[model samples]
Target: MSHPPDIPETDAGPAATPESEESLEVLRDILFRHYRERIAELEAELKRLETRLTDPQILSAIIAPALGNAIRQKIRDAREEMIEALYPIIGQTVVRAVSEAIRDLARTLDAQMRTSFNPMRAVRRVQARVSGVSSAEMLLRESLPFEVEEVFLIHRETGLLLWHISRDPEESADSDLIGGMLTAIRDFAQEAFGRGEEGQLDEIQYGDRRILIEAAQHAYLAVVVDGIEPPGFRAEMRERIITVDHTHEETLREYDGDPTPLQPVEQPLRSLITSAQPQELSPTQKRLLAGFAAVVLLCAAAFCAGGSYLWQTVRRTPTPAPVVIVPTPT
Candidate 1:
């Protein structure tokens, strides 16, 4: 029994030591702490990645291309809502602008009519007809001759120039800008005075120059005239504008800012120039009339002198000879 116990103790001698057990426990505790910290760090990193994925810029970058059509559909679905939200403000703004424009137009028309009906205006018209001059020329002779210097055809909604014709072609350089400015001014006047859709700026005067605007359903005509414009002239302009609108209604409706289609309108505008120009006497006709008048005066003077001389001769000698011959015959 003593030999067996000695052989077993040789290998199982440290089995019940407190220090070894404590070392094993410390090793286990160290492993647990390290694993727990690593797991916590991994979870924090995962949470950061998740937050980045939810970011708008990153999300849009990942999904926009694939969902573009779906996004557009969503916007379309909300369009009615957007319009409903904006309608009241937009409608109020439009109403106010239109009302202002109408008031301004009414005032302008009243003032213009007052100036047109003056006694001097009638006298000027008469003088223009008698002198073979334009009424504008007769009225403001010292400044600029009354002529339609330029004509601009513009789209009412877009303020785009459809066509422009200028007596002085140089003035056409900035016609597009002028059309935009005109539209802006018209819009401003309308907005300022609370004018409505029916209101428009018909005329703008600056010194001797005047811009006569005629509005239609889709477009307008702006004529630059220097001098007093006759009512007939304005009527003629309106008629021409109407004719153009009627003839090219389809083209104008479909206009894409190309001026080529408006070429035919040049002929009508040129005709206006021809009609407005007064038929003045040429130098040759003036000379011929002067010479004819001189000849007529000379002939009248000779006939009067000849008749006076004959009457004096008859009175001096003819009565005595007539009495002697009558007595001899009896």
Candidate 2:
């Protein structure tokens, strides 16, 4: 009777009862009721994330930094592989940029050559040969005419920049630094070269650039010039500095760090930034041109005389009569 009644025991735990399932359902409903907005928000965020993941631009933005890092790391690991892959792209970019720059330079050269066909250029060519420099170098030098780039009014004693003006919109100069340097150089020159003499360094030149300094009692004006300065340019600089000093004598004497007090001087300083004047022919150049003109006139006179003589001879000579040739009967 005991063997017959023995049943199979399961390994599983006790099955869920109906009451427990009902209690669980009630708890789930309570959670949903309390956090309904939170659940909806999480669902919306998940949907938005999915949408963003499908978008190519957003995906690229998300992956760009990582992809770039990975690429850089790969390049670091295998430089040869990356170089071989991107060699053509880099090579082409470099070649294209270089070619464009060369083309621009060639166009500029061609324009200069075409425009520089004048008597002045011819005279300069002769002068260049006499100067023992190459004609190309001479032409290049002459092409860059004199121009005032910037002007700085500085306190003579303290070397503080008072008023500054520039012709070029792109000319960003440290006026104070330039003034200080000029002052230092002047001081050094006075001590080294002209200690006893009552003189100052008037000009500081480097290559085609010149710093023309005009000193006064309180302040000095420094003019930045490019290329060779024309005649009377120094006198103009002197006049500018003198005028500035005379106009603002009281203010300049009581010099301080503030440039606002000397703001009015900018107008006068601006006047110094004049356009480059056209170069006039030298005495020798004028003489050369005169001689050339005389030779050309003489050649013209000789040609006219020869043409008139030929015309007269042709008129005096007798004309040859036309002869009719009768063909023999074949």
**Candidate 1 regions off by >4 Å?**
1-144, 194-197, 280-317, 321-330
How many residue pairs clash in model 1?
13
lDDT of 2 at 111: 88
Looking at candidate 1, the ten consecutive residues that score lowest on lDDT are: 136-145
Runs in model 2 with CA error above 4 Å? 1-54, 67-91, 112-117, 129-177, 181-278, 318-330
Q: List the global CA lDDT of all models.
A: 0.78, 0.83
Model 1 alpha-carbon miss at residue 177, Å:
0.8
lDDT of 1 at 163: 82
Total clashes in model 2, counting residue pairs 3 or more apart in sequence or in different chains? 0
lDDT tens digits, residue span 1-330, model 2: 355767889899899999999999999988787598888999999999998899999989999999999999999999999999999999999999999987876676668788845777787788889989888887666555688888888888887778778876576677678778888888889899996788888888898788888898888888888878755778888888888789888888886677777777776677667535446688987897989989999999999999999999999999999999999998
**Model 2: residue 19 alpha-carbon error in angstroms:** 13
